[model samples]
Target: MEATFVIVGGGIAGVSCAETLAFFEPDKSIILLSESSLIKTVINLHAITRTLTQFNIQEMESSEFSLKHPNITVIHDTLVEINDGEHYILTSTNKTIKYEYLCLCTGAQPKLIPQAELFEEIIGIRDTDSVEIFLQKINRAKKVAIVGNGGIASELAYKIKNTQVHWIIKDKHISATFVEPGAAEFFLSSLNKDVQEEQVTKRMRYQEEYSHRSGAALGPDWYKNLIIKGAGDLNIPSEIKIHYETEISNIQRSNNSPYALEVTLSNGDKFTCDMIISATGVTARKSFVSKNELELSNTGEIKVNEFMQTNLQNVYAAGDVCCANWKLAKHWFQMKLWTQARQMGSYAAKAMVGHLNNEEVLQDFCFEMFAHSTKLFGYKVILLGLFNGQKLGTNYEILIRMTKGLEYIKFVLEDNKLQGAVLIGDTDLEEMAENLILNQIDLSPYGDDILNPDIDIEDYFD
Candidate 1:
């Protein structure tokens, strides 16, 4: 088959790119080669701010997606090889497709612990399939050990109940991936108990499922649709024992013991469990193409320039499968997030279309600052810019204001200019926070009043 544009992978990034291409260039043929029968699409998206987007992921049938666009065709197949030099690709089913422009949204694979492959009881949560298998295992498990401090680990640690949970981490506090020690400490109380989830106008995200695809996308609120109860008939939703400042040093399967697995920690602590979840993080999928052909980052992701184009001509990549090689905006950075995947996909489409028309395309405004809205421990969380003071290290200063269970607010400042912020709860400071970071407005005169409850920050900023 031949097309003007071809996108690989069925995840949000690829699907978004395909939809955008089909929308703008209706006269041209667009092919979306997907490995799975399902495609993930973003719906009910609310642009809380320019960069901060809240949306739900809908896993649509690939056939349904194809039906929506007359020029776009969805092909259920996996890309086995890429011939960038000749501008063609080989699929697993032995079909050769040629394209004028190609975008690789192959996504990522879980970076499981080294011993993950040695045992069947240990698993890493990635797509819907892994989560389903994990649910089945936990439904019968008496005890489970969770490792990692990222979003997936934090969610699993917070949501799963009715079983003994040993949350092993190498951080000083919980939820360190999303917040600082202070914010994490605020979240500690909620971790050990069932806190009431607040209803918010913002939309919550859900995972993307393909009938049986390996590289589907994961989003939040997955537990709502599925049962998270553990072994035992009494549905007591408590008991998450957090092992802070440590990691899983070793894991072994038991042959005759009552427990299915025994795990050892880095601090010489050992625990026996029925299941183990490795949520360390994800690495790029690079098996289809060689590094020599397409440049790769140190983290094993495809390196793409400002145009989202790989080193090869007319070949581009987005989402978890690619890395931004260009110098990033001061406040904006890359994270393998649902919002970022959508932004990158949409941006990639614009860049490709501009390339075809020989038009100059400027960088997207969404790249001006890092913004995201998510739920952690059932609380609404909004992150802007370098929320954790990221690369600024200890050189920066932070102003914090909180009321325990009610809310927690933090501001990262450098030379009295707002650099980043973390607003946990219904603070309604997203617009002000994003504008302050993007405009680089000096806050020296305002001082700590920037986070003061009495001060009308929205009015001053507006």
Candidate 2:
């Protein structure tokens, strides 16, 4: 008659799920298992989003969460294996525990992108340790090269001022992940703060006004000799070099030079460098669970119903593990973000308790369209709902409002509802904007407020 719930992982999803479960069923026992002792510190790429006041406030510091939850037991051990049957789970530490329910919030791993081996070899920046090593290498580096096409690459291109940057992007254009073409242009323009727009008019195709700030511009020949290759390989020298979308085929020590290490690329390409860091994205980490433990999506994420219940009965999953159909991006599911995982954890816990009560629950406890926003280096990037453009139909009304280098706001209005937006630089109306997106509020009042920044229109949504 023990109603004990076993939660795996100590990240935001796992912690939040434990909190929710503790709240719903105070009489039931709750235990949280984590690989790291840093129970509160979840590996978040968008840590700035947590700092921003526009979103939900994080209650406990990463280190203090377990101390706050007296009812939640925490075990700091690596989850090397999981054998989740109907009533129990075997831990990596050789401990067996009985549970009425199991929650899988064990996040993801860094994806070893095939062609990104060179990038990983020279300037990888994949994690905290890698970023530290990269910074150390940069301090001593005369020139730096970047690979990949995302916010991290964009920020790296803008941040490292003294070092010469050779950015190799597979795509001809800028980040196609969050921003649209027009907004992408604006963001690209912001990178070239050292150069004026008219001075680089020939490359104007890459220069779109980012905000009213006046100086951001995507520099000239900054990414020259930009090789467009598919699934390339990366080879590294003893010094520093990064190859994009490439894999390391072979590695060996130099015969003549004692300090030199030689590497071969998958595509027969070779390069030598001081250090390598991989900014390659994260992988959905389910390696511990036996392949037959649960059904997995193509992306390696756990397949779950609307209630966050995994294919394995009583095994609930939230966060990066659960499939997410983002409302703003209009894409089905993607990994490598903390926002969806946090919401999914809360929803999963709620649904689990609801089932215990034999009560009806919402189809999905969380919203379909998840929003994420963060500041990479200095540039502000916001992703609302979904972006894949599949759910809202082919045709939708789009209004783009901008002020060069200072502000950029693109509103996706469909059926008179503010579907989604990506805001940058100026965030005066950020909270109101998010409220509108979440509630799908009528857009008439905020229309004038957007143009006239001086208006104190508190009743816009009211």
Candidate 3:
């Protein structure tokens, strides 16, 4: 089969790239190759700020998508080989695909615990099938151990009920992945509070028989439909025990013990649990091989230039499979986020279209600032550029205003200019915070009054 554009994977990046290509070049034929039957699509997107956006994710059958877009053909097949020299790829089923422009959006796989392979009972926090498998395991589990502190583990800790969660992290506090310690402290209280149970967002989910191959990594509200509970009564909230500054050092089968496995920690503590969910993180997936292959970053991801093009001619990569190799913007850095995936994918399509039309495509303005919106512990969270004071060295100062059970706001400032911000809860300051970071206006005159509760911050801006 031949197409003007051939995209790989069915995750957010691949889908976004394919859709964008179809929209721009309606007459051009596009083929999307995937291993799974379902494809993830973003819906109900609301931009909280110019750059910060929130969206609900839906996983639907790939066939449904192709029927809607007659110009785009969706092929359910795994990419196995690449021949950049001939601008073609080979799938697992021996289907030969020739393309004018090719994009590899092959997502990442879970970076499981080092000892994961030795165990027959460990589950890597992954796609719907695995998560469903996890739920089935936890259904009979009285105690569950989660081995990661990233978004997936944190969310699992909050959502799972009627079980004892031993959350092992190498960091000092919970959710070190997204927030600083101060913000972590602010959210600490809500960790156990079951005030107004989190209502699951209803969505389509495939059963265990959906397809043995794991579908794309899930996105926003992927667990909403899953009522994750343990062997205990559903009314009882899940209990979380944090073992900070520690990691799993070893795993061994219990010797006729009731619990299935015994996990030894790096700090020399041992615990028994029915199952271990390794949310350790993800490593870029690179199962397919090319004749010359593609240039990779130090982190084993495809290195893409400012235009998302790889070293190989007419080949590009995006999302978790690729890393940005260009000089990053002051406020922007790479994180393997669904939002970034969407942004990179869209920009990649623009770059490809511009290349074909011989038009100049300036860097997207979204790159000028980093923004993300998410929900944690039932609180709205918005992160804006350099939120952690990253890359600023020790020259930056932090300003914070936090109210217990209400909101927590932190600002990273350098040279009297706003650099980044972390806004937890509905502070309604994302727009102002985003503007300040982008404009880089001096806030010295306002001094500490800028965050004063009495003064309306928006009034000064107006």
Q: C-alpha displacement of 307 in model 3, angstroms? A: 0.4
Q: Give the winner by TM-score.
A: 1
Which run of 10 residues does model 2 get worst, by summed lDDT? 200-209
Which parts of model 2 are misplaced by more than 4 Å?
1-3, 41-65, 115-127, 192-273, 325-335, 363-368, 387-390, 415-417, 431-462
Cα displacement (Å) at residue 13, model 1: 0.6
lDDT by residue (1-462, candidate 2, tens digit) is 123788887666887688888878877788787765544432222323222213222323334765666667777655555455546777667777778888888776555446444344454443334444555566555444455566567656655544344455554455655666787677765564542222211110111111111111122122222221111122321121234445556655546642234556655765443333344455566756543467877777887777888877688888766674333233234445555566678888888888888889774423544556555324556666543343678676677678877777776777666766677664555555566666777766566444454655435554
Error of 2 at 389 (Å): 3.8
The local distance difference test score of each candidate is 0.85, 0.56, 0.85
Q: Each candidate: how many clashes?
A: 0, 64, 0
Model 2 CA lDDT for position 70? 62
Compare candidates 1 and 2 on lDDT and give the better one.
Answer: 1
- Once fitted onto the true fold, the runs of candidate 3 whose alpha carbons sit more than 4 angstroms away are 199-212, 233-237
The residue-level lDDT of candidate 2 at 17 comes to: 87
Could you give me the TM-score of model 1 versus the true structure?
0.96
Model 3's TM-score against the true structure: 0.95
After superposing all C-alphas onto the true structure, candidate 2 shows an RMSD in angstroms of 10.7
